[model samples]
Target: MGNLIFLSGQAAIDQIGGVVGPGDIDAQIDQAMANIERALNAVGSGVDRIFKITVYLTDMNNFESVIKMRERYFDKPWPADTTVGVSALALPELMVELDVIATRP
Candidate 1:
């Protein structure tokens, strides 16, 4: 079995602290991706190493914008993903939160 890496995307977003407020869907998605990437790199893996992703969104209707941002993080043969519409996240202002599983050589 290969080594497994677990990361917290929320920590990365906290570093960027962009103009996009916490409640904005697009902004949250973007920050989430950044956080994921940062966490992956910290573990010596990149987004390409990700085998699966689970996304929690405040509203399923915002999936379009989420997909648009996803394109920037992943390319062809994208990682397996599961998204869910949840009533809330760890943070009240967060519109999206992502948790990923990655393999490392």
Candidate 2:
């Protein structure tokens, strides 16, 4: 049976709990996506196996930049997703958070 893995939301915070990309949406998105990648690898899955994802953004205005930055993480056959803009996250400085669901072979 294929294994399904659900990764918890990853914000721009590092493993040490330090906020990343304080004022830059691009940097925050990158760090969040990178954190997801690391989480996936830890569980024997990867970005290509990602079937669905939910992205949370602090500002809707950063949509374009988030999509552009997302290209660096996901390729052409991108995963299905839903994105929502929220007023705040767990931390005041957190800007982007990614929720990943993937299958593990």
The numbered model that scores best in TM-score is 2
Write one digit per residue (lDDT tens) for candidate 1, span 16-52.
4643456577767776777777777887888888888
lDDT tens digits, residues 1-105, model 2?
Answer: 359988877889888989898999988887887888888899888888888888898899989976785587778777888899999999999888888889998
lDDT scores in order = 0.74, 0.84
* Backbone N/Cα/C clashes per model: 0, 0
RMSD of each: 2.6, 1.5
